[model samples]
Target chain A: MWFDILPSFWEGAKITIQLTLFSAVIAFFLAFLAGFGRLSKIKAVRFLAATYVEIFRGTSLFVQLFWIYFALPLFGIMLPKMLAGVLALSLNAGAYGSEIVRSTIISVPKGQTEAAIALNMTPWQRTWLVILPQALVMMLPAFGNLIIEMLKGTALVSLVTLADLTFVATVLNSSIMRPTEIFSVLLVIYFVISLPFTRGIRWIEHRLSAGRY
Target chain B: MSVPLKVIYNEESTKSIGNDLRKVAVQPIVNYSNISKSYGDLQVLRNIDLDIAPGEKVALIGPSGSGKTTLARLLMTLEEPTSGTIEVDGEMLWHQKTNGKLVKANEKHLHKVRGNIGMVFQHFNLFPHMTILRNVMEAPRNVLGLSKEEAMERAVTMLKQVGLANKIDAYPAQLSGGQKQRVAIARALVMRPKVMIFDEPTSALDPELVGEVLEVIKAIAAEGEMAMLLITHEMDFARDVADRILFFDQGRIIEQGSPKRIFNNPESERLQTFLSRFNRH
Candidate 1:
């Protein structure tokens, strides 16, 4: 009986993995862009980045998913279901991820910036070379938590009819009427999927912090 | 015999006078004109007109809160003066000439002007994440645009100068406070700056460690090619290394002269009192 249901769970797991990976890539880039944008000297750029963070973080991810998948088509912005899922997951996660970036950058010692300046590095060189490398290490733990949150958050895509793990589990259980057996498997799959990400971040944090202590 | 002797005297006096006049005519490498800085209601520096000649080793000595460090900071472009202008190597540091009129300097102007200056902080602010060699190599490779090989060669030479060649692979945290400060000196020196500012470079070190850092500084000053602005509480080091010393008190240069005159004569009462404190120590 377990072997019979395994292939169906694998199919849903693939979709879930794809959503997490795609959303994570977009979220990572958005995190740094919006992160640096918030620190920009230009008032307009700072304001725009702050607005992006506030709007995304202030609203629930569920509403954002519903709005993009259901409401956006009302205004004629017809996105595919997959695109909508990725978009909502990344945008929501990116908003939270950006605060991690900004605060970590700020926490880098003021002396580092001054030292770079005294070396005659331009503002850009100082930020990228001196500031960001140190900040990147400090940002990893928080980002690990965020990626796991995003992984779990991928379960929400089931509401839009995408056959991710949770959607497949629900459909399978309704027919078999074996909620305990099926849902237990679903919980294990989710936990299993998120484990590697946590380990990966820790490995990176260890690598980057080599000799820093 | 008397007529020939008089002719020799005139020629010798004329040559000496010419030499003195030429020395006076040489342009100062750093000039601060009517500069003042205020932090809102609190004034840090008053109207200060000062000039540092090329290759001149000038030490600034004062009680804490007398604005000695602020003077070097202004030159390093780390802090801005509220009013007045600074010139580094004959170009304005705080303002630039545009169409024959002075305008507040843009980033390019500031970068170009400040390229001639470098500073070492009290904390020895080495990049803790990078190895000692990379800490020394970073600026020359990135800012000066030297090739990696060239930067590496320069960094190695500077580290050797500061007696840290063995510690090239060590991270900053692995080094002692004195060793860290030496790496900082090498880092600043690798830039080949025209002016190097030491903002109490040895103040943060342990008492025994201070000698090592000071010895490195003394050797650098001995080379006599780069001008140095030393903000120090070590009066003995200042008297030994500085050609001229400026005594600052309450945001003004109360007295400045040859180290001998300032240390021995100490004309001002404040300077006398300041020297007395150091004497007891």
Candidate 2:
């Protein structure tokens, strides 16, 4: 019974990797834009970003899963459920990531902007050259921590019919009635994905804070 | 290179203002006419009509909350005036004259005008992400179109001038507050601004470290090219280095004159009291 799904675990692992990489990239870009929008001086931009964040962050991920997978067909815009799952997880997680990026940017000393202005740098130059670099360095450790959260978040995508690590475990458990074994293996898989991420965060945080290195 | 900044600072640019060699009448570099600024129903500056002559070293001194920083920000165009106009070299600063009517100048205009003015803040606003050399050279390379070699040369020389040559490769976090402020001063001076405004440049420094920065500023003041507008609480620095000192009180220039006239024979009781209790000694 366990052999029924052991042959497909590699396929599931591939999907998990693809989902993690794809969703991480999408979440990062969206989060950066959302963060910048949230901090924008223009009222319209700030409002739109704030509204998007609140909506994504406040709602349940399962509700988003159902809505994107099953509910959106009523609007005549049907997408494959796999795509829907990835989008749902990324967009939901992107909201929290946006806040992380925003806080990092805000934590950057205000003196940095004033210095750029006094040097006669255009606003765009200062953002790209001065502000973004510091913010990126600051955002890296938080992002490393987010990656583990994102790994767990991929589990939510399984509800929309994508055969990820959890889906494979569920299938094997049903076939063999060995729930304990399946669940324990799933725990190991999640641990394998998350442990390095935790260590990477510690390493990065240490490197950044260490002075004169 | 659209404007020959070198031409603006040539031998012909240095004409005496009557008998005073210390004062020059090159051109009306910055004219703030009836310029007033406020923040959320609080009027910070009232009907300011100040004309800074070319090569003038004006020190702005008053108690805290006297609108000195606001005025400095106004001249740097960091904040828009609530009313009236500012002109730099006969060109309207915030709004330009278009077809005989005043209209807002575009970003192009602001860039060109703001290019000519450099200011240093009291907090030494150095970019933390950059190395000290990069901080000094970024504007020169990006805005001034200086080649990497030329920018490096100018940056090194400016670093030497500010006595920060050894710490060029270090980040701001690695430097002392005094070192950071000197690097900031170097960053400003590298651009060769027509007007250099120092907003309490030494106010944040420890007493031991303040002298190095003040000495750098004093040397910059003596070089005789850039006009300096200084905001300082150092009474001796003001009395010794400032050519003219303007006393401000509650967002108004209550009195102004040479440093000796201000420190010795102050016309306003406000100035006398401000000087007596000032304990940064």
The C-alpha TM-scores of every prediction are 0.93, 0.91
RMSD of 2: 4.2
Native-referenced DockQ of model 1: 0.74
Model 1, range B1-281, lDDT digits (tens) per residue? Answer: 01111111111112112423423444667888899999999898999988787787889999999999888888888888999988787778999779978799998999998999999999988898899999999889999999999999999999999999999999999999999999999999999999999999999999999999999999999888788999999988998888778899999999987777888798989999989987885
Candidate 2 lDDT, A69-93, residue by residue in tens: 8889999979886788778878887
lDDT by residue (tens digit), candidate 2, B1-281: 12212112111112224433443334467777787888989998999877676677788999899999999887776788899888776667898667977788776778888887899999988887789999999999998999999999999999998888999999988998889899999999999999999999988888899998898898888887777889998888987777678899888999887777787787778888887787534
Angstrom error at residue B137, model 2: 0.7
Candidate 1 CAPRI level: medium
| lDDT by residue (tens digit), candidate 1, A70-164 | 99998999898889999999999999999999999999999999999999899999988899988988888888889899989999999998999
lDDT of each prediction vs. the true structure?
0.88, 0.82
